[model samples]
Target: MKSMPLKLALVAGLGLAFAGATTYAPPASAQVYVTQVGVAPPPPRFERVPPPRYGYVWAPGYWRWDGYRHRHVWVSGYWVHGRPGYVWHPAYWDHAPGGWRFRNGYWAR
Candidate 1:
């Protein structure tokens, strides 16, 4: 029957997918420290603030490209607990010949 061949193809495709699942690497964006994708990401959107909290510092939102989706996603800013003697450095994208590379945020002492 025609359906028999279609079912076989579907099974084969699924088999291949499962077989390669373990070997799949994270998207190139995660591994790339820098990119020259050419176009600059849009400016970060505004974050609303509530009354100041005692010990939390603000982590500003920024855009990170979803390489798999081929689009920019907004990483929303949030409050992080303050570390004594350390300043939280927000993540930012730097432009180069290879486009913008993301610098991960960190607490710099």
Candidate 2:
């Protein structure tokens, strides 16, 4: 009989925990284009890093945040012909409270 009350209490506790976990508010999105002093200029242009001796296409350059400042960084794009039906999503930045956050580009099929 005593075990019944203990079991009920355990169930109630678990229900409260689950409810609290689901009620959490998500953090606000960060800012992406805030410029700070001492930020380094974009990296020098170089010959396109040839794609893997295959048919991969090259994507252009973009800016990225370097822990300290925003620096222009080139993420050499590649040709992905295997997935014929896929489309490339170019990389982008999101502004956050801290600084610019880079979202890596990806291929979508």
For model 1, what is the alpha-carbon lDDT of residue 95?
78
Q: lDDT per prediction?
A: 0.74, 0.55
Per-model TM-score on C-alpha atoms: 0.62, 0.36
Number of clashes in every candidate structure?
5, 8
List clashing residue pairs in candidate 1. 35-98, 35-99, 36-98, 36-99, 37-99
Model 2 accuracy (lDDT, Cα): 0.55
lDDT of 1 by residue, 21-107 (tens): 844533223222444455688888988866777878888888988878887889998877676677677788887766677777677
Worst 10 residues of 2 by lDDT: 25-34
Model 2 agreement with the true structure over 18-103: per-residue lDDT tens digits: 98985553333332234433444454356566646453445555565555444565555544443345555655655565554556
